[model samples]
Structures are given as C-alpha cells and as structure tokens.
Target: MPYAKLTITVPDAVWIGELSRAYPETRFRVLAATADVATGVARIEITGEEPEAISEDIRDYDTVTDLTVFESDERMRRVQVETTVPLLMTSLQNSGVPLEMPFEVCDGEMAFEATIPQQNLSKFGETLDGMGISYRVDRIQQDVESDPLLTDRQEWLLDEAIERGYYDTPRRTTLVDLADELDIAKSTCSEILHRAEERVLKDYMGDEKGARPTVAVSSD
Candidate 1:
C-alpha cells in the first residue's frame, strides 16, 4: 500500500474549475461525491464572503442540471449538485481508486489525497495523462502497512515538540520543558521522542538496512 498526495490543475472548461478561477479567494471542498458513466453528484462546501452569489452562478451552468443549497450563511454554503461527470472523477472510477473525500479546490487547482495499491498507482497516473489533466505528485509513501506510521501518543508528542521549537536551530525548548508541559517524566519524553524520530526518519529515507544516523537530544 502507498499513500499519495496530488495537486491537479482542473481544466478551466469544467464548471467547478471555472467557478474556482472566477472566485480565486473562495474555497470549494467536495465533502462527498459519487458518479456513474454519464452523471455525477457532489456535496460541496463553498466558503468565502459571497457564497450566495457563487451558488447562484453555479446554477447558471448548462452542465449542472440541478443545484440545491442545503445550508447557507454569509461565510459558507453547502450544496448538492447533479452534473455531467468531470474527467478526474471518471478516471478514478474507471481505475478503481478510492478517493479520500473532503478534498479541496481553490483557484482551479485541486488537492487530492489517497491510499492506493502500489500496482494501480502507475495506471492512475497514465489515465490522468491520457485525459490531458495537468497534475503534480506532491508526495508518495511507499509500502505503508495497514497500521499508521506513528502511534497516537507519538504523534501528539511529536507535534508538541515541533510547535515548541525543539527541533529549531538554537532550540527554543528543551526535553525537560516539553516533558513538564505534557506532565511526563524527562527520561520518558526523551525515549518517546527518540523512537518517534527514528521511525519517521527511517520511513522517509526508505532505509531498510536501518543504517540511518541518530539525532542527539539535549537533556537540558
């Protein structure tokens, strides 16, 4: 299994792409979407200053057959729309790749993330290329297991450490301060951080031989 993050530049001819380009400041999050061969439906959350105006504009598009605004306010509007299937969605459907929902589109670019089978990754890329879709693969994590890379506790501690500048040059926070803030002992914090760092670095380097260098932690 592998995890991939892609940034796709939606063609301006597509309704959603055109709308996003028209309102560059607005964010369109496709919370849920489903499509067949000819038709597709998506529940999208439009967030910006003028969601009402945006919604109205969407209804004017000929491809969009129906648009229902389920929720609306000054800052956000949630709508479900029935429309002709976009090329990206069609490709995903045909390739049998499960798209992680709640993906975003802003200024005609879509941020897509998915966990895909290693074998299907190349096929997916080829399909996108065949459709003339412009895209960039931002990241790919290969051979990821069913379990997550980091444990919950490790993730929480790592986040705290980074936020506190433990990894910063001329580090702003020490192991003692970090442990104290989390109500854990200094030695325990050090051990947990070391384990977390090792796991992350090893995964990043793809160093199966485990010859990666160790990071020194200040006990102070």
Candidate 2:
C-alpha cells in the first residue's frame, strides 16, 4: 500500500476555521473525531504557553456548546469538544483510505497521514473536492519494496528511525541509543536494521525477480 500525508485547510466560512481564527494562539490537536447520524464530537488535546487563557477561550467558543477536560498538566491539556466539523471527518472516513494515527489539527488546517491504494489517490482527491475542502499533499510513499518484505514490526522501527533522525548526516542517535529507546538489545536492533536495509536495497535494485506487488482497493 502507498501512504500519503495530507494537510487540509478549512475555509474561513466554515465553523472550524472561524474557531481557529478566534483562538490563533491556542494549539488544538485532535486526538479522535467521531460522528453519528445527527451529531459529532472531537476529542482535542490542547497545549500552549497559556493554559488558563486557552482553557477560557475554549469555553467561550459558541460552537463547542459542550466542552469537558480529560486531563491537564503543566504543558498540555486534553478535552472532549462538541464540534460542528464532524462532516469533515465523515468525508475522509468514507474516502476509502485507511487512516493512520497521529492525526493533527492546528491553526485552520487538519493534517492526516494514511495508507491508500495508488489507484484510489485520485478518488481521495475527488472526495475532498466534492466536499469543497482545500488540501495539499505533503508527502507520498509509493511501494518501492515488495509487500510483506518487512514485517509490521520492522516497518514501525524503520518509521521511528527516520523520525528520530537516525539517518541524518551527523546522526541524531546511535544504534545503542535507538535500542535503549526501543527497550531492546543493541544487537537485535542492528539485526533488524541490517535485514530491512538488505530487503529494501534488493527490491529497489530490481534484484528480486518475479516479485509481485499487492493490489490496493479502489477508493470507490
């Protein structure tokens, strides 16, 4: 499957955009969003320099007729906010893309990273267009390696490695550091990394003859 990271900006005419503009200084990270036939709610984890002010502002928002805190600390606060933006979530959910974690909402844009079929890419875009939402594709990963070449665990580790700057020129972390972070032995981490690299290189160089790629489902 191919994966893409997209950032969608809601128009100012929309309720969510209005709220975002109202609270320009507050950062709202949507943890989860769900909708029913008539109503929708979004669990937002908010964090900013001024927790008290941010909390007050959220309470003042008319759109969030109901708001309740889940947790609060010095740096971050979580809350369930009744939203008028459930339609946006529903649109994406029905777009035939398997949403991955780490969904984000900050400023006036919602950022989503998901695994999608290459063929459905156009359909996904069309869905957004049908909803009148503006968006941009931040990144895309096409299948350069054979399917199942790396186990889910291996793929996760690779993602972590790239995120933590392990592949940087100066190297943000050593293999030992990565192992410590993963709570695994350095040797095991090394083995997994080496094997993953070998498989990826072989596939990229077209050395794996008779390799078959998985067909992805259409967005429709």
Query: TM-scores, in order shown?
Result: 0.67, 0.60
Top lDDT model = 1
lDDT over C-alpha atoms for residue 60 of model 2: 74
lDDT of every predicted structure (CA atoms): 0.89, 0.76
Q: Candidate 1: list runs displaced more than 4 Å.
A: 146-220
Task: Supply the global lDDT for candidate 2.
Answer: 0.76
- Cα lDDT of model 2 by residue, 135-172, tens digit: 99999987565559888878888888988889999999
Error of 2 at 133 (Å): 0.6
For model 1, residues 1-220, the per-residue Cα lDDT tens digits are: 8888889999877799999999999999999998888888999999997999999999998889999999998999999988886666787777778888889999999998888887788888888888888899999987535688899999999999999999999999889998999999999999999999999998878865467677789999
Candidate 1 structure, TM-score to reference: 0.67
Clash count of each predicted structure: 0, 0
Backbone steric clashes in candidate 1, count: 0
Instruction: Name the best candidate (by TM-score).
Output: 1
